[model samples]
Target: MDNKIRLFTGGTQPTSVGPFAVNEAEQVETRPGNRPSPRELHVTGTAEVSYPADRASVRLSVGNNKTTVNEVTSSVSRRLEYILQAVRQHGVREEDITVRKFLHRDQEVYHMNAEVTVTFSDFDQMEHACSVLLEKLDRSVSVGQPRFFHSAECLNRVRQSACVSAVENAQQKASRISQLLGQSLGAPTLVREDETREWRSHGEDDEEEDGGGGRRGQEAASTQVTPLPRIPSVTASSRVSVYFRMRDGNRKKY
Candidate 1:
């Protein structure tokens, strides 16, 4: 049996005995077959683009409460009309607005409650509608802002930019790595790609309240709106992946 000791950590010595004695030259030679050729390299590249959004969408909710479900629903329907009228008056096109959701549910404090949601296209128009409903209706109504958005063309363009960036990045990285290894980048022998989309929302979420910080009338007249208005901004992002091959010579394709 044999024994040997080597430094394992600060002020620490580890011992090896019997079959534990290590062979440095044998280990290096054994792994030579597994070592990668100097000319090969792998890298990831990325690209991004930002553009102003050209459109917006928003939904507004209006509701009423009463002793009975039917009565509450009828009351909400009546006042909601007025609310819609006010929104329309602000220049929101009829086609742009849609009834997204509506419901009549029982409330413990009030007995019956009704709610209606309207979606609009323009941000400015949505804001204006909310302002009028809060003022002209002279009652506290739930007001929500339009959601900003971008066009499909803009999204596609971003994707293409990302792809280009990824490929270029891979090429540059491969070139540097090959240079360090005493070789040159080569044409891509194997290639692959992937992508992703991300969306971020910007807005304040305000609570929906009845008439005046409290529930009141059963059948408030439906709110009415005017014409339509301007759009809002929406942003989208994409990511790309690429693979490149490296050779031992400078004759490489981009």
Candidate 2:
């Protein structure tokens, strides 16, 4: 028995040689087909805009506990009606108001609660309604502070303005950098928004309303003066990454 070992070498095949790689004579050829990527300047720009809140929402609730369910219900319902009337008298539409009632029993005593929520476009009117409701209602009624926020349209506009400003800022930066490098700034090749951020300047707390305004200890001479209301400001920001083509200052394009 004869055992012979055969070795096969693998390399570039002659028939598969590309036309751009080798000529007919197979002497090896090259073409200047692959072009280098165009020079570009990448810059990131950010912009933020603060917009005043345009809408306000106020929540008022009445809760009481009594031996009988009917007694508790009567107490809550009386104040609930007054709150609704006060809100409506200040030009609030019916659709902008919401009402809810809940009843439960704890041991021998029954508890009843009623909540009213009203949305207002005018802050002054909202304040007036709240003042009137507080004056007429008993200490059992709890009135929450007004929650201010921007409407959908207002928020959308603010974000759009911020994005546009960011792009403009990027263009300005690219132009300045190009000038400093002794190159001419060319048209933008790519633009993309990398991130967006939004925040409020003030508190965004939930319904933390209490029947009593405050503890007697917290009151001081400074607290005696009525402080002006502080409306929250909504801020929207945008960050954009931009790529602009780099052109030779001395060269002219045909």
Candidate 3:
């Protein structure tokens, strides 16, 4: 048997189709289920405020070397007791004084050391206490410079005020930018606080305290004592980023 091949042909060719026409309204309208994208503006603002220090801390150390630990310990304890008593007479509370460090190292001569800290809210009292310790205590006792800083309540209050000012600054910036674009600023879409910064500086009036009458005058008259240096003020700053919606005056809302 011989293999045979058969070919089949259609009677009419298919008609060529042209591109569909789009009306003006259909071209401009968005897809029925899709929502419009949001419009927003971002701006950053910063603010800072300074406050005087309300607290001061002083560190003192007592150390001695002797042939035996008992002798050194006894000597250090007696000196510390006298120092504490002198400090308390100037209004330092027992709770505000703390033993910060104690160390003992064995050697040919037994060495012992103890550190104490005193905190004060009143500068006059602090000055008086420091003067008494320096004039009356043994030379072995060392006094460190006082460190001044704002209290926790003061820091928190200043920080909050700075944040509020920063936000207001961001809003004003956004409003100006929106006006330039022939649009108005709507409600803020997002707000975030940025990293905060702080700085410290000695205030000008810090030296004036030494010249005034009080503990300063008494110390000046008797021993020609140098007035304690003025405490520095602390400045706190905050930054914030804000995103606000924009509304066009001529455009209708969706």
Candidate 4:
């Protein structure tokens, strides 16, 4: 048997641990390959929120035909003024009222038309104003059905809440899936909204249509021929795609 002994005479010596020897210079060097990306689980989440209409708009119009433009305009103006007064009396703001006029000549008779669009925050006041106009003007003026919708602020909040709900749903789904697959759920790697949609649902009362010219007397009590003043709801939905880190469930993390 032959035996050999080695002596080290250097500024720095290599340290031996277990089966490998490492020096100060080798410790500062990075490993050859970059770390691999973590395992990811992909999922889609969807959520929707429904909110009742907050405000409404109604359009009213008056028209008259006469031999002279002045006469036709006068008649239309009187009715238009009366409509404005009624709308104002119901506590509607001035900025909420929009008025438009049109005058045209057809052969011998001159026709003049005036339209009033009013936005109302209070549904009761809107109903009352429409009722007054219909009851007084009757066949002379046409009142359109009130179009109900959510306000800007309300819509923004609904959309944001829906998005947040979708993300939370994604996290829950990912957690359950990872648990079932014998893996651990980690932080979300990526999240993005993939799709969004908004729609109005009238439910059973969708049979209602844009009302025509006003009906006589007691008919105005119904208020634009709608059924029972049903409050329509606006529904907003959001879909998101999320990527979450997945780790081996059996492996202990350092």
**Each model's lDDT:** 0.50, 0.73, 0.71, 0.75
In model 4, state the lDDT of residue 210: 34
Clashes of 1: 32
Candidate 2 residue runs with Cα over 4 Å from true position: 1-39, 62-79, 103-113, 135-141, 149-158, 177-184, 202-229, 246-254
Each prediction's number of clashing residue pairs: 32, 0, 0, 0
lDDT per residue (tens digit) for residues 1-254 in model 4 = 11111222222323323321222221123456854334566677889998888889999999989999888888888999999999999999999999999999999999888989999999999988898999999999998878887889989988888889888988788778878889877666456676788997773454423355445434556556546656788888887766665667976422
For model 3, residues 41-89, the per-residue Cα lDDT tens digits are 6677788887888889999888888898789889888888888888888
List the candidate 1 regions with Cα displacement exceeding 4 Å.
Answer: 1-40, 46-78, 85-114, 120-122, 144-165, 175-187, 193-242, 245-254
Q: What value of lDDT does candidate 1 attain over all alpha carbons?
A: 0.50
Q: Which candidate gets the maximum TM-score versus the true structure? A: 2
Which candidate model has the greater lDDT, 1 or 3?
3
The whole-model C-alpha lDDT of candidate 4 against the native structure comes to: 0.75
The sequence of per-residue lDDT tens digits that candidate 1 reaches over residues 194-234 is 44455544434333457664432322323333324333333
TM-score of each: 0.39, 0.57, 0.50, 0.55
Quote the positional error of residue 45 for candidate 4 in Å. 2.7
Predicted candidate 2 versus true structure: per-residue lDDT over 131-156, tens digit per residue: 88778875767888777878999999
Kindly give the stretch of ten consecutive residues in candidate 3 with the minimal lDDT sum: 1-10
Candidate 2: residue 151 lDDT (0-100) = 91
Better of 1 and 2 by lDDT: 2
With a 3 Å backbone cut-off (N, CA, C), the pairs that clash in candidate 2 are none
For candidate 2, which ten residues in a row score worst on lDDT?
Answer: 1-10
